[model samples]
Target: MNHEISNQLKQNQDIRENLKFLAENFSGKIVFSTSFGIEDQVITDVIFSQKLSAVEVFTLDTGRLFQETYATWDKTQIQYGQKISAYYPNNKKIEGFINENGINPFYESVNLRKQCCHIRKVEPLQRALKDVKIWITGLRAEHSPNRNELEILQWDEQYELYKYNPLLHWTTEEVKDYVTKKGVPYNVLHDQGFVSIGCAPCTRALKEGEDFRAGRWWWEDTSKKECGLHS
Candidate 1:
């Protein structure tokens, strides 16, 4: 195998093995966050199939998600019978921020967008990750330019926790095949041209022949496409 693929396989194997180890070693402190996307569904299947311990699944209900996304979240809960905890932005913070900056100030500049993302997603992520030693995410290397070098496992400097991306090595096609074959519940928006789903106002559908992430934050330059969630 090429060095890159070999490294990817090693990392992938490490995450699967480490997840088992952490479930036993850490017992009630591991958590996983999902956004009801295809990638999230694949990871959800791993945890559900393995019956991983202490793995609390959660989602951020930004109150601005597409109705289809919420419907998928509900379907996923019913299919797995595992409660996916919902986190909402603090009402006071959201209201105050919108009042001061206008409802869509994110269109003004990248900084404003990040500030909004911090209020809606980042802060909630911090709270979700609190007391959790291992944080599992649905990040894939193909999702973004910055993520091409990401490993299946790494230490999150900002959160001070061990991060795991079990599906990091899998291609998007493989992810879809697994979800389809396993009958895993996923956001239907993926079929409608949204490769990635975030808040409704900030995300858009990609055009034919566009990059995977071109649909998200499309108004900004391609280099500045991310919300505070990943970076």
Candidate 2:
């Protein structure tokens, strides 16, 4: 991490205050990527309700998202009166991929799934993050075992930017409590056991005691489930 960002991380303040500090100092250079999940909604509430003008908010619309996700997206806009930019996959690439492979090739193999994610997510994410300095996320340690090693603020060499996970230490219950108290717009699928929501085809409701990320790409090995956007 940069020494300046490290210093800011050492402040030990609440998420809202820390986010305010980052927004003030890194004005026009900060960006938040959301997927309309509960944790993302909490951060969206903080950014919009606090009027964090320095932050740019965007989402990758993979064209395979659930109808509920779109509804939550609209509700979020209505609540905050702010537009969250939507980034789409390149039409040419998508067409080529679908023509080369089947429309649902991801179910064939892990490599195919990763290829789908790369086209629909990673590529668009790169475009969304172009020239960004600080990338804020809704990542929580408990979301996945892989996320446990992540720091609250860390350097992302792939994007060449500082990544901030303001909700890094927050539990699932804490996220829900905060969202309820703040009246943050969230996806209703959460109440139906969809612990972590993603593109519709790749996600499903989890059974009891399953990991939060288990609902996403459940057919793959646990160690190989990331969509490459965060990795």
Candidate 3:
């Protein structure tokens, strides 16, 4: 972490104040990626409702997202009147992979699944972060044990930029309360058992007492399930 900037961020009284500081100082170099989850919706509300245009907001469309996710996307744009940018995987690469290994080979093995994630989410994210200095994500430590090791603001050597997890310390209850009070639009799947939603085929609503990430890649071993987007 850059202690100077990190200290400056800590000086802010709240997330909005910190975001405003960044907007005023690092305008045009910051970006936020959302998936319409409760946590992401909170960030979107602040960035859009507050009209913090300095931070570029976007999503990675894996082309396999649930219809409910799409509906939430539309409602968010309509309510906020801000067009969230979209990034898709490279056509040639996806098409070539599909032709060579069938459309859903990711179901066959972990290696295949990772390849799919790299092509669909990671690659597009790489393109999205090009020339970007700060990458914002609605990551909370409670989401997974892996995230428990991350700081709210830190340098990501993988992306060659600073990563900001504004809601890192926030609990699930706090995030839900923020969304409801702010009237931020969110995915309906959350009303069911879906604590974490992603691609349609890859994600499922959690059963009882399951880990946050179990909703995604439920077929894989419980060791660590990441899409390569976050580290």
Candidate 4:
């Protein structure tokens, strides 16, 4: 299945047609998770603007998002209608962690940080992806060194699903240009140098020479920065 999908993608470089093909073949099993970043906005535009009704679009609300992100999401729904579903962290798990760890224990240790991420992101994602077959994302190759090696389509053993990163080969500049040209509603933080925006407390604007990965978890070592959702 992966090989056939890869060959089909290789044969057609048009993203819209590729997505349409997936929707036609996969039907109701395709789920796309967007974080409302530039790349995600681009993908959202393609899916919504094109009216690919078979693809289910959604977001993971970590409850720590920037106001700009919420505004962008609102604008997007206004523009394209309310097609994006929101999956939030488990309330019980969130309460338990905060009560035991003082609300910000993620700042205290790497293990604690990962634990927080697991509760706030990974666990909620597990629920969103339950019984889902084709898990789509807005991941791009320019984001990190680790992501640069990933193929456009592959099987995820962890979730036992076919993970499809439709924008995997796109450049950062290409993504920015597409969003601008499409008049897509995007988070204004990108213009302010905030790359890869996630939770507000964990994200920051990139400095002059920092890479895409530098904006999030800036205080930690580069090797330990991932929140485990992608890693």
Native-to-model Cα distance after best TM-score fit, residue 130 in candidate 4, in Å: 1.0
- Candidate 2: list runs displaced more than 4 Å: 1-5
Clash pairs for candidate 2 = none
lDDT of 3 by residue, 1-231 (tens): 457778987565488888887887788999999998989999899889889999999999999999999999999999989999999999999999999999889889999999999999999999999999989899999989898999888889999999888899999999989988878888999999998888999999999988888888888875798999987
Model 1: per-residue lDDT, tens digit, 33-109? Answer: 99988999887777776788478889998888999998998887788777789888999999999999998998999
lDDT of 3: 0.90
Candidate 2: tens digits of C-alpha lDDT, residues 105-182: 999898989999999999999999888889999999888888889988888999999999889898888999998898
C-alpha lDDT of all candidate models, in order:
0.82, 0.90, 0.90, 0.87
What does candidate 4's lDDT look like per residue over 107-144, in tens digits? 78888888988988999899888888888898888888
- Clash pairs, candidate 3, are none
Give candidate 3 misplaced runs (Cα > 4 Å).
1-4, 11-13
**Model 4, which residues run further than 4 Å from truth?**
none
The 10-residue segment of model 2 with minimum total lDDT is 4-13
TM-score of each: 0.90, 0.96, 0.97, 0.96
- State how far residue 69 of model 3 sits from its true place (Å): 0.7
Q: How many backbone clashes does candidate 2 have?
A: 0
